[model samples]
Target: MVNTRTTDYWSQFIVDYSGGGDFFIANAYGKSAAQLSYDRVLFGSALQVVENIKLINNIIVVDLPVSAFQGLSLSPDDRAFYQVIADNQHLTGYEDLSSAFRPKKRIRRVDGPYEAEYFDGVYSAEKVRFIKLSRKLIEGELQVGVVVYLAQTLQSRNEMAHDISVKALQLVSVIFTIALSVCYVFIWFIVRPIRRLNTVLSERAPTDLTPIDTDAPKEISELLRTINHFMMQLQNTLDRLKHFTSETAHQVRTPLAGILAQSQNALMENDKPKRHSQITQVIDSCESLSRTVDQLLNQALLAHRFKSKALEKVWLGALIKEVSRDQVLTALQQKVELAYIGPNDDCQIVGDTVALKKMLQNIIENAIKYSPKQGVVEITLIIEKNREINDIRPRYGHS
Candidate 1:
């Protein structure tokens, strides 16, 4: 489209120049027939072209010898106009002239307006464009071809286009900068609090399970709350561990000291019976100490499992039977009869199996221990419908 428009202006200019030649003939209307005939050929067949604010002072015929247009060719000192036609033969036809001129040769679309030089003429090249125009004419009985070239320099249009482009680029750059700044501000607000939390956490000692204090957004505040909850749990666990360690040391020390004393007593005794009794006491003390250690270990394991939320379905009848069997020998030694009674159907309940078994065992054993000689330690599983017991106490009765 740009090429077409460029060629159009040049073509219009050529037509205008030809009209000027016709006016010249009109002024010499009263001349002789031979002169009028010559003027008609000159005005009708002559190619009128303009370039760089100057008229085309030279002309040439393509197929004919250079001498044919001798007077017309010698009119211009600058042969550049003729040189353009000789280089592009397609510019000879009126129809092909618009399409033949390539933008690369004569037209340049620049980023900004600047000065342009053409045909020894310097003009503001801002929006200036060049085009080639051509047409066919009749000279007597022969068909002659005429070509014209022209330049259209537009300073106002170039300045407008350049100004619009600059403003558009500036607007895009401003928006991009604002978007980047907002993202940076958002990231800083989010990351700053997290970094503070990390610092507080990293500076704590291994044993320091204290809750943390954080001044942060709601989301970060929730995260801190979870951390504090876990820290409280850890503190509780640590306290339990300390208490268990001290109790174990105290409980273990007594039986161990008694065992040592029994050993020394056994060594001093000369009589076989006396020595045997001392050895028996030492064995009993050792067994009791072992039982205490086992109970303490099992308690620790139960606490750990509960902390992990480990639970399972347990049958009350089966659990009671198992505990009674384990305590049967102990009950026999204490001269007590251990018995278990349960419903025909198994009573199922959800709880930690290890903890439940230990609880039943401790209760039955205590009952047997406190019972009189020849007393019965009868265990019963009583199922109460729609009742949840908040507290329970074990009682023993001698029969």
Candidate 2:
């Protein structure tokens, strides 16, 4: 009985040891399975976080595992693959699962505080801006891992800016066109009166010195008045010249005829005394002709001097005496006694000397010519209370 009991106890102890060994092995296997399940759950959570970020922000996210870098998690998009480079500057893994995007140079590992970089390049034959981000994970052994974020191209933004510029240019062109049109109209109205004035002047004859008759603005009207005044002065000058020409011709013809007739009469006379008388008459006629020519020349000279010379201080009494002395010969030939009766004191006046002398000479010559034989022609200078007056009178002798 004792041997049987010992056998039973030993069998029982062996069975317990086997069962405990099996339990220890099964517990270790279950703990390993639970840890694997936890890792999968955590990895799934990380992928979900990455997907949520991509959905909210509209960007691509790539999460790479350092231990098994080939088993990386990527947000769902049209992009085909992504290249993962290690901090050692070596390409570690790539997502070759999809055939959507063509192979291109993607994100590079960055070492500084900034995690992103921007570059410009051609993508699918269109200009685009490429934005890349590389982030180092700092939790656990995953610190060796990197997270990449990418943004879409900036083609749309550039197109929007171009549209705005085109609209601004169009608006400026419209404003410039309006300003040009307004200026053209304003200038046309301003020059209308000038064009009419030019036309009127062009159509008139060269000899026509008549005043212009046209409606115009105040400024143009003032100009027209000035032009009319000039025309009137020109017309007066032309009329005076015409009259002077006719008078000169008549005066010259009369003296020449008288000289010719007297010369012929002197030649035909038979008696010596009568011939001598005729010759004397011819000499007188010649002298009269010379005097007439000289008077004409002096008149012309006086007219010119009156326009050109300024007034001067003249001694009126002295000028009168000098003119009287010059005409003494003519007075004797005409059988007239010329006398100057006035105050001996000389009188002063503001006048042109040539003009005053000519006036006095004309008065004395007229008085002497019209006087009867042996008549007295007196040039009297009279001083009144307010002014000086010169009196030329002819006194005839009774028969």
Candidate 3:
């Protein structure tokens, strides 16, 4: 038996006597091989195997011609490695030895960073060689076989390593597949939520400019915020345009009605004295239409000027008073009152002065037209925490 810490040399001795294990019940004898005084026992099975086995220098040796080796080409280095194996005696020293084999100090291989395997097993192709013993049973019942030690080589070890590497790579392939599955599922978790968020944003209600609650995953929040800001501006611009259009419609339609009325009345009159008055009425109606069109044009032009953003500091009270005074003649003709209610003291404000002047003209003219004769049109200015529109009211339309 081979001990856990020691391979039995007695195991080799048993081969010289033609046996596998050192112990056996003798078929018809007084003792077993285990009880024998010598390490080896001569058996009837030995004679049958004796001729088939080869021994040289008391070292057992064997050579096998393999069909697989015959078909392959050998490198010069590998050829040299095989020659060293055939010439090596240390591996075959057991064949000629008369005395029982002794346990050897293990040999270390200098060239191998690779693993070395020793085979003392029965019928191992690379290590032990077995042969038939006379094709016959021996000692009335014992079956016999030949055993020998073969040479070792770097080439042989290389072949085994290649096979083992292939098996290891196959195991790694399985692990790689499992890892890919995990990654695919993780990415799916990420894309699914993003797709859902995209659907929600694109499908938003048309009437609702309310900011979308994207619940964005840290990554897209800044984009969502920008989208929301744009939506707010768009909503505000649309509202302003709607109100402007309604006001413009009202302003334009009134003059058109007056012109229609004047023309009809003039057409009905035959006297030259009455004809002159009707023509004057038509002329006045045309003037009102012209002023409304001019104001609208000025508003458009001023809006273009505002884009330059050259808002300079100008005196607010003076700016308003200048525009109102210029239009006082028109106000008087309409039998409406015009006045500045603000502090006559200088109050400087930051704005485009030209645009502000135009704004005041439009506002003041609106007040004069809507107010009754002797109505008080007061423009009050306050220099306070901020510019307060409440401090002044054009009593014409907004009573």
Highest lDDT among the candidates is held by which one? 2
Per-model TM against the reference: 0.53, 0.43, 0.38
How many residue pairs of model 1 clash at the backbone? 0
lDDT of each: 0.59, 0.61, 0.52
User: Could you tell me the lDDT of residue 380 within candidate 1?
Assistant: 68
Residue range 255-319, candidate 3, lDDT tens digits: 88988987888898898889889889889889988988888778766865785478888877777
**Model 3: residues with Cα > 4 Å off, grouped in runs:** 1-187, 300-399
**Residue range with the least summed lDDT across 10 consecutive positions in model 2:** 69-78
Best-to-worst ranking by TM-score:
1, 2, 3
Q: How far is candidate 2 from the true structure (C-alpha RMSD, Å)?
A: 30.3
Candidate 1 vs 2: which has more lDDT:
2
Worst 10-residue stretch by lDDT in candidate 3? 37-46
- Cα lDDT over the full model 2: 0.61
Model 3 Cα RMSD, 1 decimal = 20.4
Clashing pairs counted in every model = 0, 0, 10
List the RMSD of every prediction in angstroms.
18.8, 30.3, 20.4
| Model 1 C-alpha lDDT per residue in residues 1-399, reported as the tens digit of each score | 379666556544533353443433432331233232332222222223312112232334344234323433332331221222433454442443333334544322121122221221222322223333444444455454444443333333233343343344445457768999999999998989999999999999998888897697886898989999999998998999999999999999999999999999899899999999999999999999999999999889888989986578877778778888999899899988877755556677889888888888778878988898988877766667774322224445676
